[model samples]
Target: MSRAAGRLKVGIRVPPCDRADRIVRTVRRAEELGFDSAWFPDSQLLWRDVFTTLTAAALGTEQIDLGTAVTNLATRHPAVIASAARSVAELAPGRFTLGLGVGDSSVAPVGLRRSTTAEMREGLTVLRTLLNGDEWEFTGPGGTVRSRLRDPHPAIPLHLAASGPRNLRLAGEVADGVILLSGVSPRTLAGAMDRVREGARAAGRVAEAVPLTVSAYCEVTDDIEAAARRIKPICATIARNGGAPFLALAGIEVDVPDVVDGVYPDLVHAEDWDTAVRVASAWVDDAAALRFAEEFCLFGTADEIARRLRALHADGVRGVFLQHVGSYDPPLDLIEAVGASVLPAL
Candidate 1:
């Protein structure tokens, strides 16, 4: 047997918006930069088709892993999602992971809703079964039907993006890995881990065996406050969805943002830059925003961010994925900075 070499792992998430040229360039760049994976978001109306983008990346790049940073089970059928995931796996071989989540941005635009925990369980079961080429019989419109994947891919992993206690626990029970959305704050991340651990224990599984990927919008900027301001909408989103853990870091509850009441999914992408920051101020004022920057985002100097990242790895974080602020544009600046300073530090 031949021994394989080792490499450092770094994942960058990109949304395939209107620019096909930009997406391809970014993924190719990531591969050149020695990144471990290139993940894409899925929202048919908000961005480009996730599978189409992944397939393109698979054919375009030779080594970098390709995946959905996440796709929603609420919007797509499990059978269909499994088939799409299997097809991508066929292209990339062992480098594809299917990251599933309850619907959010994708469902909101169409006046649909996210799937509940129970729904998620059933959906994952069906998706995994069929992806393994095992006939899975489930009740359809009128009765049950058995089906299997035409091209099975049992190696493809299912990573769940989860935060709420119950849902976090569910990830521990079933997911191959978990995409931690509870923020980078140690307090909240620790709390979220507790929920996941509880779930894993209840399921008779070892929590430590499951890998965890923590994500944040990262940038190296001298003016951290300004960078933080750009992230207000995301802060407000955490508040609106379930801010208890995040709020604990800020020493407050979800009291600041009535401004985000009517916005769908999040105010970050729904409004313009100026309007989004302005509305985010209703909750994330100067002190709060700065605190948010320090505690949650990767928006500090390279030295500072690198130190914290090492601390996160010490805290059991397996890998980190950095998201660019805007969905449509690539974060060349952050990527360059992280590659220069952050990746080496880790």
Candidate 2:
């Protein structure tokens, strides 16, 4: 069925792990299943080229919105990102959003540091200038040069994915939308939104004008305790990376080693998810995992998820993009389950 009026916007995060054509099929299927949007993450080493997958998706789907759940300015220059965004926006018109982040897997493997807050400010200005068909200056080894994107797509919305307080505020000041990496805990979400609104007011913008989309791990299961095991790595990673306070807000506390061995790349995007779970289980017990699931994730029956989503919408969340457990495969099951059961309920 088509989207109904006043229904909360729902999206899915699909990895570009396969061929472009095959990835396009997954996006088309999500569209057919009534998902409002499809977001693709970018990591050169981990997945296929994100822009290629997005381009294919744009051409293959008729009505679904498309976005980079996030791409980075570190691995790719702002000019390159602007040019690529314009290309996809050309194909999809008003259906494309360009999401930016400080970078993680996309930069770490390449021996590049993630962009600093100052760098992100500069990068956003450059992107805005180029995408709006205005000239921007670039300083390089060759020399400083001024350039403008040819056939720029100015209307492409720029979303920022942020979890940290500083970045959350930056998103408020500049982004067309905010992609909250903070999970769905009400206390944590409220605190994050306060920072965003503070920045918006400081920048002389209305807080309500900035749409917010929360990114949370979601599962449809009768036995939530068992399914909660999959998020052990996520809990450990959050605690390891300065989110212990956020976890505490959920009444969950964890302390993990700075460097976890055995999991390739990282815990959040571990290739061997079972192994990662095993490694993380030492720090995060079943009770803690269950707590995380209940607080930060949409884990439960369809009715439960529907109620939680409606509550989130009432609390001013405009959209939410559900992410399945694994990063390697398409969330086909999640799409089918939620679309059939949850969307109609919403």
lDDT of model 2, residue 278? 98
lDDT of 2 by residue, 228-338 (tens): 998999999999989999999889989988878899899989999999999999999999999999999999999999999999899888889999998899989999999
lDDT of 1 by residue, 1-346 (tens): 0111222256888888756656878888877776777888899887888898888888888888888988988788898898899888888877888999898888888989998999988888888889888999878678987778886888888998898888899999998888999768888899888888888888999998787888887888889977887877777777877674577665644455444554434686663666777777777777776777778888888888888888887888877788878765776766777778777776
* The candidate that achieves the highest lDDT relative to the unseen native structure: 2
Clashes of 2: 0
What would the TM-scores of all predictions be? 0.93, 0.98
- Give the poorly placed runs of model 2, Cα more than 4 Å off: 1-6
lDDT against true structure, model 2 = 0.91
Off by more than 4 A, model 1 = 1-8, 252-265
Highest-TM-score candidate? 2
